[model samples]
Target: MEDIIDKRMVDQSEMSYTVDILNKGVGQVAKKLLEESSELAFASVEQKSTADIVHEAADLIFHFLIMLKATGLTLNDVSEELESRHKN
Candidate 1:
């Protein structure tokens, strides 16, 4: 998924709604993330199955990646931070 996003970010000729939102800047990515998070929060207790939570979580992650990319960050950057925090 990271590779896909990375490739598409440069060659944006095949722009989809997600990519369009990404082009709009960090705020759009953040908005999508917040919306997804709200859905996931409600789904956590209200939804009987884990499917709803998983679906929302995936959306959240996708938007998060978009936001991260917009901010000139990557999953490896996040992973490094997590690893450093773990070692502390």
Candidate 2:
């Protein structure tokens, strides 16, 4: 995903939806994250199929990564924080 973002940012010739969304800026990305998370939560509450839940979860994680990139952070950064908290 990081590679996709970097490549798309450098080469505009390719049509990548992820890049398009990222280009829309953090506000849009955050909105997607919220939407996806809501869908996931509602799906869980509605007792949707396992596949449906997984789909929503993937969407949420995708937007989450985009948010992290926009904010100049990474999964490692989040992991480090989690590790520190676990040790406390």
| TM-scores for the candidates | 0.90, 0.89
Off-target runs (Cα >4 Å) in candidate 2 are none
What is the per-residue lDDT of model 1 for residues 1-88, given as tens digits with 9 covering 90 to 100? 7887888877888987767988898887888889988988888879647887898889889888888888989999999999999899
Clashes of each: 0, 0
Compose the digit string of candidate 2's lDDT tens values, residues 1-88: 7666667767988868777888899999999999999999999999999999999998898888888888889888999999999899
Q: List the candidate 1 regions with Cα displacement exceeding 4 Å.
A: none
Give Cα distance to truth, residue 45, candidate 2, Å. Answer: 0.4
RMSD of each: 1.2, 1.4
Cα lDDT computed for each candidate against the true fold: 0.85, 0.88
Q: In terms of lDDT, which candidate is strongest?
A: 2
